[model samples]
Target: MKKRRRDLIQLSILVVLGAAVILSLVLPQLPGRGRELQPLELSVIFREADTALWSNTRLGMEQAAGDLGAELRFLTLTRTGDGAEQTELLRREADGGAGALVVVPADPENLKLQLSETVGSCPVVSIESPLEGAGLVVAPDNEALGRELAEAVLEDWRGGMVLLLDTAVGSTGVAARLDGAEAVLTAAGVPVFRQTAAPGRLAAGLRVLSSVQKAEAIMAFDPYATEQTIRAVEAGGLGQLVYGVGVSTYVVGALERGSAAAVAAWSDYAAGYLAAEGAIRLARGEAYTAEELPFTVVRGEDIYEADNQKLLFPVTS
Candidate 1:
């Protein structure tokens, strides 16, 4: 009996020692128990600062930084959205120890050479606009977005005058949208009449709207065109369905009130999320490839749905 007790005590002592050794090996790596993650720094550079449009993007980058256990530094140029300014900003960011970069080239074509020289070996992602020689990109296909809008409108209207209100100085993506819209409408045997005006030129848009004598459905490229045409139609007693490429409180209200049909644009929040994720991956010595984001269309009927609400009003999209 004494021998049995001695053996049992020895076994108990061994078990305790084994547990102590295991804890010593595992406890040092537990983050919650005091160890902290290595915080990586990432940068998101935009062409310009538009809070209404880019608020969601900021939220998205914040979330991505959290998810990736990294930090985000957002940078933007003035309202001009100039390529030269963006190039200068890129140089500064690269010199600032930015582990990775995500940029929206104001003028991709013009800044191609500058980008090549500045980006160097660091991982760079492009959003909003494609940069020449940029391997990784994430943006909505403007042509596809335009085609989606045109297809949606074609279901109701046919073989009539379709008015397209666009900006006089449009970006490349905007031109792609216009091209897609015209191609689709033309193929469907509908005639498209386009009128151009500059941004912040409400009177110019309204003047163009007044000149559109007859239009079955009216589409606009920029927010100014969209909002101005909708306002003109309502005030002047012009009965025409309006659609466009942006969404705001006014646009959503218009959609609900039957003054607007639908609007198409890339979810800016999603853009930020994807861009941050890509930056994190690249910073971690991972690879990336360029791809186009999907287009989103919000109409009056399902605008209130949970998923749509998340996409449309996520940080005021």
Candidate 2:
């Protein structure tokens, strides 16, 4: 009897030990591991151009990095949009031995090639605009955004001319949004007037807005472009006739003033935060995938409220 009892106790101890080993292996996969998250180093390289937007994005990234106890390096190659400058910065960071890199390349074509040669072995992620064959990418569903914008236009104006404002025709993000918008509009048998702006010219957006003969709505690809269109329409005394669709504080203000009809905005803060998270995951020798943060469409009275202010990144405004 004594021998049997001792055997039973030993077997129970073995079972408990086995269970603990299994738990340790599966705990990280469970939600909120709550382990003392390790500190990580991440380099964020912005495109030489879009300084203001990059700054805003960096703020979010920094905040997230701080929360996650990670070190962040935010660098810009030039004040103006220069692909060569961005390429040089990427090369430098790679040589400096960063744990991970989050880059917004200036020129997709040239930067893609340079990145392939320079940072090919490193864990690199892209946001806003994706680099082809990147390890990770964070961007809105451009097609979905486009469809949402088109539907917003249809809701306000059923049969009038709708103008689509894009920064560049070849830009992957812009092209995707345009394609999505076009699909929805075509399905509804609505005509779309699309125009591409000159590189780095807000005036080009205004020019398109001014040139529209019977414009019912204007959908801008970015916040800055949206602001320019609003200014142009207001100056031309066409604010009442034209509806704007954009994502930014300025666009929200426009909506409050009844100038912008709707704005589809992604969480810049969340993207920045997630970018930092991805960097840390990469640093931990863990494989990670690109992901998109949640997005919201702000319009009507919600644009002016304090609660709705979350839509705008803290860094931008």
Candidate 3:
């Protein structure tokens, strides 16, 4: 009887030890143990490498990602026309477990459908270009931007013709900008002529733009077009004044050199941050939606102002 009792006690001890070992091994993964949360996976796609025009937006995304404990995957398509590349990247990221997506679409309209079919369930945020299928889009008010620039031209009331230039092969947003600017210019009786420039064809654009009389004011819809206009001016000055819609490091030089009168700078950082945050919220089943980032018409002197200084110098990291 004594031997049997000792054996029974030993068995109980062994069972207790085994249970404790199992619990120790498993408890950390259970809900009650530590309750730690993991970071989410987020991704972003750009038409090309990050630039001064996109630095603010990228920084904004980084800030939001850090705050939200998300990992950001940034991809750039270097080719001149790579809309298809963007769609493929979208598929690859989604398949590889990206919970949310943010993109500056190479072809905004075509990417819209591809995004829906490939990652339709994932919450998507469109950066500068608005996507029809995205859950939320963060973009500057381009119409307001165009209107503001035109108003500035009206204030100066330069008698020379106003020239509008855009390189969007198929962009709806450019149309909105043109409409807004034209509305103001036509109302004020500013003569306007528009031309589309092929990529790396500034000379051809110049030849196309040539007229008997020089233009009074020129509006370039995007930064590239603006740079071409600047290059054209450097090669052979065309208009009396120039205005552009986006910000680039070169913009500072343009303003200093008096090549560009002013540029309607969009809150690119806000666009990046808000789009990322909003997409995350949507992915997490929150009630997040589309938002419009603000814009500012900045000139050479305006760069000295506190707000304009930040816009002039943005932190990307």
Q: Provide the overall lDDT of each model, using Cα atoms, as 2-decimal numbers.
A: 0.74, 0.68, 0.75
TM-score ranking from best candidate downward? 3, 2, 1
Q: Model 2, which residues run further than 4 Å from truth?
A: 1-41, 48-50, 54-56, 77-81, 208-210, 240-246, 304-307, 313-317
TM-score of 1: 0.73
Model 3 lDDT, residue 11, Cα: 100
lDDT of 1 at 49: 46
lDDT of 1 at 261: 88
Return the TM-score for each candidate structure.
Answer: 0.73, 0.75, 0.82
Off by over 4 Å in 1: 1-38, 158-160, 168-170, 202-205, 208-216, 222-240, 289-291, 314-317
Better-scoring candidate (TM-score), 1 or 3: 3
What would the per-residue lDDT of candidate 2 be over residues 181-219, giving only the tens digit for each residue? 778877888777777664355534464445465666767
Tens digits of per-residue lDDT for model 1 on 256-289? 9988888885677777888888888877777765
lDDT of 3 by residue, 149-234 (tens): 88878887748788787566555665567678889999998888876665356634564556414577777776656766776765
Model 1 residue 73 CA deviation (Å) reads 2.8
Q: Judging by TM-score, tell me the better candidate of 2 and 3.
A: 3
Best by lDDT: 3
